[model samples]
Target: MHLQKDTNPALNTVTAYGDDYIEINKTRHQRSIYFTPEGQIYDLGIQSPFDFTTELLQKITGVCAAAKSPMDFLDHAAPRFENPEQIEVLLIGTGKTQQLLPPELLHELLNARVGVEVMDSQAAARTYNILMSEGRRVVAALII
Candidate 1:
């Protein structure tokens, strides 16, 4: 969506861009945000009384956000194979470029023993789709 100057002062103009796969927008909060098929943005002022960023990641990964202590979003995105010996990788999208994740969260994931890789949102989505089509249970979070 293109950002246009609104005549109504109450309405803020949000600029959005994307193709068939994903969309990124400059929200009213002035933060560049990403969207998922679940119809939820990464940070869009949802009141849940919890860390919404963490919760969104869990939801996108199809894991029970309440199950574990802040379930590893990456691991949830890329689920474990039926055979424990099989290795899985999670592709996390942080936007136009790979952004740093919360250090504490990263440490937690590493401690839980899951393979994690961070990439830009577009690349992450593409890679995830490729892996899944190849009969891999990989998950991706596209920011935008």
Candidate 2:
């Protein structure tokens, strides 16, 4: 058997998390956040799942959508991705509990071919780390 090592030492990983905060790469964030496996992190400023609105979701879709893919995340210009293969699914961490979002809210993402996974913040964090380690194109929006 062969083992492949992650070449990027700076890749962000969820280190610790609690009901009120999440630690990524050893830094703590009390607010919600969005992160990619490549170490790109952004504060989402969402205090709860209710703060994760359709507009915010649209922005996320813009960030993750492939340049050549359908413009399904609103009418804004889609962000170009260096590696289209790096984006697969989006993990939504619904704060302290798992919350189901309306299917219509995710319709655009689905049309763009991006899968959605919704879970509690803690579970989402763990899943994000695992998917990232495996070099899957994954993004996480964790509500802390």
Candidate 3:
């Protein structure tokens, strides 16, 4: 809500977003940072949001050229959890433009038992924060 640090430093929060930089937890980073409700933050490389995970954040590819479609990217990284089906929704931040997802992409997510929403990076960040604050099972794949 506020462009400031979290009341509790133990949690990771997005402080502000600039043209090509994002300030998270009071630290300005030009690179993307993957964070979870659990408050752990990791530097996300140039790879798409698919490569970042709550437990392990790794850059599997340089720029994800193999992903001809968004669905390919979405299915690229499936998190390791007790039950992957527990994740209710996935928020995808598509850089500066609002992305219109294809039916196949939606079908893929539905098949995975997860809902999907696509928005601009800023909205994605805000929504991800708010939903995460509410203790929802959410993951943000932000294209910063």
Candidate 4:
């Protein structure tokens, strides 16, 4: 029932994630969430995560849809430099199951220089919070 508030203020932290929502700074969000570096939390229409660059977040929007295979979502994280290194890693939460990443999608991200990790939403939420606390350039596309 308590969120240990950190003295230093950063982007809101993921306190918890439930069946269909994510908690940030102790505020329980019961719907899909779209959070940018900016303070406000908007409805992503599917809810997703972090001081994350909006550019990166926007890029993720390009591939964040509910699909049986991640291939359904496209890779848009490639930067103009055309370096796949634009994003170091992307964490994907595939609902309640640990599904395989689409080959095409995985290939695109690898070619574009991004690493991908697939897990369930709960695990992803925990991982995301850990990475964010470490100040890594990480993002998550979550489904609850």
Candidate 5:
């Protein structure tokens, strides 16, 4: 991991493999994304306000709502899929509180042959980039 200062204060100064990660001095808003070379944001292309609602908000919320515990949001989010490896990392973001994912959900994923890795949304984003850079198949849900 490498860090580089950026001229733009709104952008993250740290660069991992020449990609931006953290952003400073700006209001944190929802639906905002920072991209990395390894991870191309996956747009499931779900339809309507449903897409934005789920991809941007509901998914995160659902994970938290289901967990009923304070855990890192990434713990609930979907996992990343890498080559030859079936384990997936799910990034759950807790906007203002700590939360945990329900055990049943994790089990469901595993039953489907997907490995689960949980992290906060920010870490998930960064990890997504890293996975993408590594040339893994990543699927993300986004509003059209």
Candidate 6:
């Protein structure tokens, strides 16, 4: 699907998506990723939503290895924010299907007051554009 440009072109918007990848701001990402509307995109190397764990968050928090840069696979991307508290909402797109994350995996986010919504990648992409265009502090973690 191809999404029309929003009023806020500077923000990362899902221009198009498919069963295996999502295009953000005309850039194609084939791996799992999390991004804020303000243009922070973090590549989560896990192949499936089932592979998501607190360790991934740990990596972003500087407790583990660095995450891969979506822009350049050979380069490493440093963590921009310290924690999930930076965003008000978290959209978790569980690949081609909608799968609810186990509560244990979300305990950290809930404790940080981040509201999470689980859905399929397509729905997450649509919802992300709407929330982002509205200027809300939203982060989307999509497993492609």
RMSD of candidate 5 to true structure, Å: 13.1
**lDDT values, one for every candidate:** 0.45, 0.76, 0.59, 0.57, 0.36, 0.75
Q: Flag the better candidate by TM-score, 2 or 5.
A: 2
**lDDT of each residue in 68-106, candidate 1, tens digit only:** 435667466543313232325556766666776765544
Off by over 4 Å in 3: 42-85
Task: State the lDDT of candidate 2 residue by residue for 74-126, as single tens digits.
Answer: 66764543324436788999988899888877766776677899999899998
Instruction: Report backbone clashes per prediction.
Output: 3, 1, 0, 3, 19, 0
The alpha-carbon deviation from the true structure for residue 98 of candidate 4, after best TM-score superposition, in angstroms, is 1.6
Instruction: Report lDDT (Cα) of residue 21, candidate 3.
Output: 70
**Superposition TM-score, candidate 4 onto the true structure:** 0.62
Descending-TM-score candidate ranking: 6, 2, 3, 4, 1, 5
What lDDT does candidate 5 reach at residue 141? 24
Worst 10 residues of 5 by lDDT: 17-26
Candidate numbers, best lDDT first, in rank order:
2, 6, 3, 4, 1, 5
Instruction: Report lDDT (Cα) of residue 28, candidate 5.
Output: 28
Taking all chains together, the TM-score of candidate 2 against the true structure is 0.76
Per residue, candidate 4 scores C-alpha lDDT tens digits across 5-119 of 5623457677766676677777787765544222566554543322223344436633332224445347543332233224556777766667655455465455555667878
The count of residue-pair clashes in candidate 3 stands at 0
Off by over 4 Å in 4: 1-8, 34-58, 61-85
RMSD (CA, angstroms), candidate 2: 7.1
What is the TM-score of each predicted model, taking all chains together?
Answer: 0.44, 0.76, 0.62, 0.62, 0.37, 0.76
- Candidate 6 lands at a TM-score of 0.76
Q: What is the C-alpha RMSD of each candidate to the true structure, in Å?
A: 12.0, 7.1, 9.2, 9.6, 13.1, 10.4
Q: Please identify model 1 stretches exceeding 4 Å from their true place.
A: 1-87
